[model samples]
Target: MRSQENGPIKIDGIDKMILNAFMENANIPVSQLAKDLGISNTAVHQRIKKLETSGVIDSTKVIVNPTVLGYSTMSFVGVFMNKPSSYKLVLNSLEEIPEVIEAHFTTGNYGIFLKILCRDNLHLMNVLNQKIQQIEGVTRTETIISLEQPIVRQIKL
Candidate 1:
């Protein structure tokens, strides 16, 4: 099952061209897509459908401006668990916290990595003290707040 998704994606020349076009403009019109790919509109539509079904393409969405919405800080928290069996409970608890934008289980000094976003230092402190640190298995947390976000990419294609 893993190999099926990992294996070569069956893309023809037209599909690659279509993906290139979509990379530039996700909301491109079907007629324009066909024109850009030099294929029939129906072919472009079918290829897009295939890409979506194969998970080569995900849904298009508007990028939210974090500064506009008052989310000024982005922080990474490295959480260390007290015990070996604590990982599951810690992960479940982390999943319930909305501020945890991204989390990953790692094989290193830290058991979990959490990407957190908040409006200010006060908000982050509260979240760490009142929410994250209170989780059952959490022993220690190390936080690094972002000074600047130089590059952010959704994906090229």
Candidate 2:
């Protein structure tokens, strides 16, 4: 429960234990979790349901390995637009491109930032020159290819 209006929700030690366990393995069985936590299966289920209702748990997802599908190159792109009003249209256009895995309306030199995946440098160039640059409002783009990603994890509970 939240202590104040629109404030962060308050959770106990047991709640933290449950969240940490689930964070390690979302597919962990409820029975196993209950046994590890020394609580009943019903208790674990109730806590998870409560966490979901309180908006702490958004949704479970299957993380995919892009390399297995031949998407080896990962690049971050900073996109500049002709005008701020073109944001919505540009966003809608970006949504249609499957290579654009993530997009952000950020506070910096670029009006928008994108994380894209492709097979190689050539594929990245084609995506940038042919698709992204062709957007009506897109004026320019700056791209940086990732050589290695050492850290990728959620926030500490």
Candidate 3:
């Protein structure tokens, strides 16, 4: 149940209800959840603690909107590394760049896939040329700019 890679945790009906409520609004007060579930506030608090200790719930974070920050460009870049051994080095370099929001090692033609956010196309180009492409082991990259994102959601519980 505690293994993250083994899929969902082993949880009871009450845990499921608490999780669903948390997933909808991470900041929801435990007292509110307790009242809604017809349970004591202490019970709700203990359930939350258990969920965290058991790894069912990770850290709660505020989700920020890129558009509001004037970062209008979102690009997916497939990076081709010079060698497989260079992955660690490239990843370290990518992590240093503020524009590279997310990176995933994959089993496809490319070595790594990157999600980058920028102020505009020009900013993206600057980041690609001055930062990403300048890495020692980066051979090439193919980037696709997202025109629109219609669907974005967390996994269904």
- The candidate that achieves the highest lDDT relative to the unseen native structure: 2
lDDT of 1 by residue, 1-157 (tens): 1224589677767777788777777788999888866779888788888888888777877878888999998999999999979999999999898889999889888999999999999999998999999999898899999999998655543
- Candidate 3 residue lDDT tens string, 1-157: 4555777678888898888887889989888999999999999988889889878788899999989999999999999999999999999999999999999999988999999999999999999999999999999999999999998877666
**When superposed on Cα atoms, how far off is each prediction in RMSD?**
2.5, 1.6, 1.8
| Cα lDDT, model 3, residue 87 | 99
TM-scores for candidates 1 onward, in order: 0.87, 0.95, 0.93
Say which prediction, candidate 1 or candidate 3, comes out ahead on TM-score.
Answer: 3
Number of backbone-clashing residue pairs for each candidate, in the order shown: 0, 0, 0
What shift in Å separates residue 152 of candidate 2 from its native position after superposition?
1.1
Best by TM-score: 2
Model 1 whole-model lDDT (C-alpha atoms): 0.86
Better of 1 and 2 by TM-score: 2
Query: What residue runs in model 1 are displaced by over 4 Å at the alpha carbon?
Result: 1-6, 154-157
**Candidate 3, which segments miss by more than 4 Å at Cα?**
1-8
